[model samples]
Structure formats: C-alpha cells, structure tokens
Target: MPLTFTPHPFHPADMPPVTLITDETDDVELARAAHRSANPARGRIAVDPTPATLTSAFLARDILAALGRTAYAPTRAPVITAAPAWRAVACWFIVDGIRELTVLRAHLLTPERAEQLSVLRELTGIRLILLAAPSSATQAARLGTCLAETGLTDGLLRLTADDARAFFTRSLPTTTPLCPTFPLSAAPVSSQPGAARSQYRAGQLAACTWLARHRRATGQVPAQRDLELFLSRLTCLSPDPATTLARIRGAQGGFTAEGLRLSVPHALATAQGPGLSTLPFTARTAHHISRAVPGPPQLAALASLLFTGAHLDRLVQARVDDIDPDGRFLALPQPESAEFDHHNPPPPAWYAVPPSARPFLRAARMFRQLEQVPGHFHLFSKSFGYRLEALVKDAGHLIPALSHLHPGPAWHHQARLTHR
Candidate 1:
C-alpha cells in the first residue's frame, strides 16, 4: 500500500500488443522501477497492478490502492461507493486530481480491464502510461488484444529506455512535511502601519474578523477543524456588515503578509468602539455560547436567528437538505417542493445565513446526516423538548431583554435559543 513500485488477459478483436515502454533487456522489474521517480503529490501515480482476480471490482480496488484512497474518510470513503466500480474508479481519478497514471504490467491486462482503464482515461482525461514487456508470444498477442480493447491506438507515445531514463532522472521524497509556525490567530498580534484597508474588500475581511475575534474569545490558536470550519462559515455570510468584513481582512493579511498578525485595523478599532475586555453584549453572548450552548441543533438555531430573518417556528421545520451546497442560504419548504412554472416560477423562501454563522448550521446538518436522517426530517424535534428549559435558561442568562422568564406550552420566542 505504501508505494512499492511493481497485470490481466484478452479476447479476439485484440490488436497486436501495443508497444508501451520497453527496456533494452526485456526485464519487467526494470519497467516497474520508474515508479520510484513518479511524484504522487503532483498528481502522478505509478501502480503495481494486482490483476490476478480478473474481476472488475478487483481492478477498481487496484486503481484505488495506487491512488492512496484505501482508507475511510468523510469525503473519500469507498465503502458506500456512490457509483459502480468502473465509474467509481473514474470518479476517484478526478477527486484525487490525477493527471498521469502509470501501470507497471501492460502485458497482464484483460480486454475488460483494458476497457475499464481506457474508459477511465476518457472520462477523466488522465494520461495512461503502460509499462512492461510482453514476456512471451502468447502474452504479446493477448496484450495487443488488450490494447485494441483499450480503445487507444498503438501510436500512444512509446518511450525507449533512453527516453524513460530521461523522463525519470530523479526520485522524489515519499512524503511532504508541514510547517507549524503558520499563523493561526492573534490576540496580541503586533499591530503595524500599512496601506489602509479598502472598503471594497468583503469575504477575506469577514474571515479575518472571525479569526481575530476567535483568538480574543479563546486566547489560543484554533484547532485545525475549528479554523477550517471558521473559514467555511465566513464564506456563508453577507457582506453588508463592514465591521466584520474589515476584521476578517486583517486576519487574512496576517496569513498572507510576512509580519502583520491578524489584529483589527485602527479604523475598525475606533469604529466598533471598545474591545473585548469591556465585555460588550455580543461578546458576552459569544462567551456564553462557547461555554453553555446545548448542542448542534440549539447552536444552529441560535445562529440562524441572528441573520436568517425567519422566526423560530419556521426554523423548527428545517430539514437536513434545507441549506444550499455553498452553505449560504437555507431555503424554506425545500427547493425540490417549491413551485416552478413555465413563465416565472415563484421563488421559494430564501433564508440567508451569515458566513459567520454557517459553521453552526453546518454542524447541525452534519449531526442530522450522521444519524441517517432523511431529507424531510425536522432538525430540532428530537432535541428541543427535553433540552428546552436548559436552553431557555441559557438564552435568558445571555440576553434577558428578548427572552421570557416563563415557558409556554408550545415553543415560543421565550423558549427559543435566540441569545446564542
């Protein structure tokens, strides 16, 4: 599995074994040796094909092993294959961004496997390099047939030993290393005089704002997922709030520029008024949410409340599929069920999610998805009733003005998680 550089069969209609790359002495190991010089990081992978099983599933798994995806992850897990084997193979080629795929044993391929590879190449636009000499006349005939089935002409650029040597002049190191000194956030990031922040800047400005405030709130570098989720949330927000935008830009500047840590600009410092030490109402609420928000459903509901323009009742009906792919809008009634006509279809209700609040909504969506909740399932039904009192207590503690001290029989303004 760890990149050891190292075959398949045929039917008639087989073209003569198309010459791929051949060494001077006809040694297959020599043919496979070039993989040592291939750079997997740069989207080039040379596979040692495990072609013994001869089934399509086995071929698909062989390709995956070469691409380094024989592992489970939220995005790349292959167990729940979204497509059939050959299609999955093609899909992963795109997902992993592969440009060149080198297979070590060209002579061993079956017509079926050759067809799969050729189809994959067609679908993904990946360059296929077949190596190894057909060790016998039978293998040579079969390989020719395989190549014909592959739908590639014998004209595939044939590199001689000298050319192959020229191509793989050097080997790349096996792994990439990470740098730790990369900026995470800045609570006391040293401020500096620079060109003034442009008022026109938007998304990056929002990112910096979140990072600056996050550092102020937590007093340390964010966890990796937290930073990624924070950026993702900022992507969801509206740009009208210039204060948030400017702060976000400052945070970005820290990462891009050499010396500037993500401190708020003097313009925002003066305009937004006092800093976190003064304990502004929103800041206090942020603290409470950090410490006491019940869970994803409650937190997401509170986040949506800030900018969604929808009431608690509307949000209570939110389903896992409500939000758009970009995480910016939550469409009420769901887009699929919304009316569309020939002339001008009436648009469904578009509820906006501030980029700053998208992470909360995303967390809630993920929570629902993990439980295998269907698209139409309500997000809040399970958690709301039992946790309602605790949430109301927290809400009131954070913002007494908007919250009711006593509860009603059904969910109401007083019972909502608005303060978070």
Candidate 2:
C-alpha cells in the first residue's frame, strides 16, 4: 500500500488542523500502517480502536499506551483504570508533551465515542487523525458527520497510499528526537552528602599518581602548553557530577587505549569526581514529576521539594532574581513577615538545579517575565496554593512521600497550630 501527506502538514498550535484518512485493506496492511505511523518522539500516537469495546475509556487506554504511559506499579494502575480515564489521559498528554493523536478504524466508533475524542482534542490541543475503511458510502458519510460536529474537520487533505506512505516517511516534528527519559529508581547517586566527595578524593589521588608514574617511566612529560590544557580539563567543574565523571573516565580510557601505553586504573577512571554528575533528585521522583506535574511552575516547585527536602515556605519566598540567568542555580531566601522589612536582608542559601529541573525553572522564569512580574516578586508565590497543591494531588498518587497528604503540603507542613 502507498501513502502520502502534505509537505508541510503540521501546525505548531493547540488547535491545529485535523486529518481524516479513509481506505480499505487487509488486516496486515492495517497493522503495518499502525506500526509505521506511531511516533512517540514527535508526540504522534497511533492507536487502533478496540474491537471488543469502543468506549472512551478504552480509547484513553490505547492513547495512554501509545503515549508510553505504563502502569507498572500497583499504585500507577489507577492512572489507567481510574473511573474517568479521560482526566488522567489529559494530564499526561500535557505532561508528556503530546502534540498529535491518530485513531485507526474511525468508521467503527459510535457518535458518542467520537465526541469523547473531540473533547480530548480540545483538552489536550493535539492534532487528531482518523483512519477508517471505505467499505461503504454510508460509513464514510457517518464518519464525516462525526468529524464535522467534533470540529475535527480542519485542514482536510486527501492523499493516496503513496502520499500516506510519504507523509509518514518525511521529516516532521513527529520524527524529531525525543527528550531523555528519567525513570523512577533508588535515591540519587549521593545517598550521603559525603559519599560523592569522598569518592572523588580517592579517585583524584589515584589519577595524579598514575599520571606522574606514566610520565616518569615513559619519559613522556607534557609540554608546558599541553600541561596547561590538560590541567584546565582535569579541574573543570561539570554541570552534572555523574556525567562529568563518566566523560572523564571515558577520556582516560580513550587516552590509554590510543597506543599511549598509558592507562589509569579502572577504579580511578570510574570513581566519582567533582563534575557535572550530581543527581540531587531521585530518578523515581523525576519520572513522576514529568507525568504528574501540570505546568512548568509546578514542575520546578515539586522538583525543589523532592530534591531539597525543603518546605513550601522556602519556595514561596523565592524571588525571580533568585534563579541564575542559566536557570542552574536557585537562591532561596528566608520568608520575610509582612510586619517587618529588614534594612539589609540576609543573603539567601543557594542550591543547584538538577539538569532535569533546570529546564522547568528556566521555563517558569520566562513565563513570569512574559507576564512582566517585577524581578523582586516571589517566583512561586503566585502558584504556591492550589496550583502547586494539585501537583501533589495528582503526583501524590504515584509518589510515596506525597501520597498521604491528599495533595496538600509535605508531611511536616501537616501539623497545625491550635487557636484559642
């Protein structure tokens, strides 16, 4: 079967034009089409309608799976099996950065089920494509009516099998590379504050000794220029502790393996070093935050809480100026009472934003700047209440720490002060 699509078929908007494709083929063709069309990286999801049930919930389940949402944990199962799957599905679409959805076998869906898909489009702003069999004129007409009512009738393009095949083959946002996924796992590399530091110290001594010994034995002392460059590289501070360490280890291995008769010990090469390889945030927390947090502001806030273990009070006190220009460092000042304004405010404590959290922080900062908030205004105070609370409510379902609060403050904040 041949397929085709427009050269420029996508619009970067929430309510972009929708597409409808009609064709008849063997089951094999349908299977092939579904497989080839699904592009999770581009947020392009292709879901074949369920044969047994054509309900919205089933549709949501298919979309969720296509979007790569898995309910591996018993707690996570509710995300897919919830009473109204649409709500969960909608949240995940935004969180996962979904841009388009394609449903196969559109001709078999009932008007009600089709309407539900329409609602999903409105909620998620994903471009929708429906592929159906042209078995009968009556079915085509019925599908047309469904599309019209649901406002699914936008940028309608008619293409043959060659056109469809080309459409799926060409380069589009749908074919773009995907962002790195940070799955939930054990606590970050630094279980204790000193572990990484100690490891780095141990590795540093080994690396220096090995380099000196190799230079003495091989009479391969570095020239002044080369020594300066090597020193600069060896001491540079990397953004991530783990990644930098990996790069250093890899570099050492390459140097030794490159016919240099010189090689650092495996332990030295693999040891944790002061590099951009820090994992302040837990992998599990990072995974849930991306799927559970609704917006960038919440994403940044929840990430801070998860990594810093700080209360909302500190987050609320954050100033737009608290974050660095690169969105890498955040300085959290103490909350000042309305009653007193110090002549000279104390300097705030600074924290490094993990690589995953930095993007959200940068986005949130830009969002505030677009709204033209004064530099001194609270960065998260405006979003601190329910907006942030909802973050916990949804993410809490999957995050063990926040699961008990019913979407409120962290455990420590639950304590109350009794009034007279």
> Candidates' lDDT values, in order?
0.48, 0.53
Candidate 2 lDDT at 358 equals 65
lDDT of 2 by residue, 270-383 (tens): 232123212245444465556644344555776666544444566678887888756666766644445436975644544556565665666556545534568898766435
**How many clashes (backbone atoms < 3 Å, residues ≥3 apart in a chain or on different chains) does model 2 have?**
23
RMSD per model, one decimal? 16.0, 14.3
TM-score of predicted model 2? 0.47
Candidate that would win on lDDT:
2
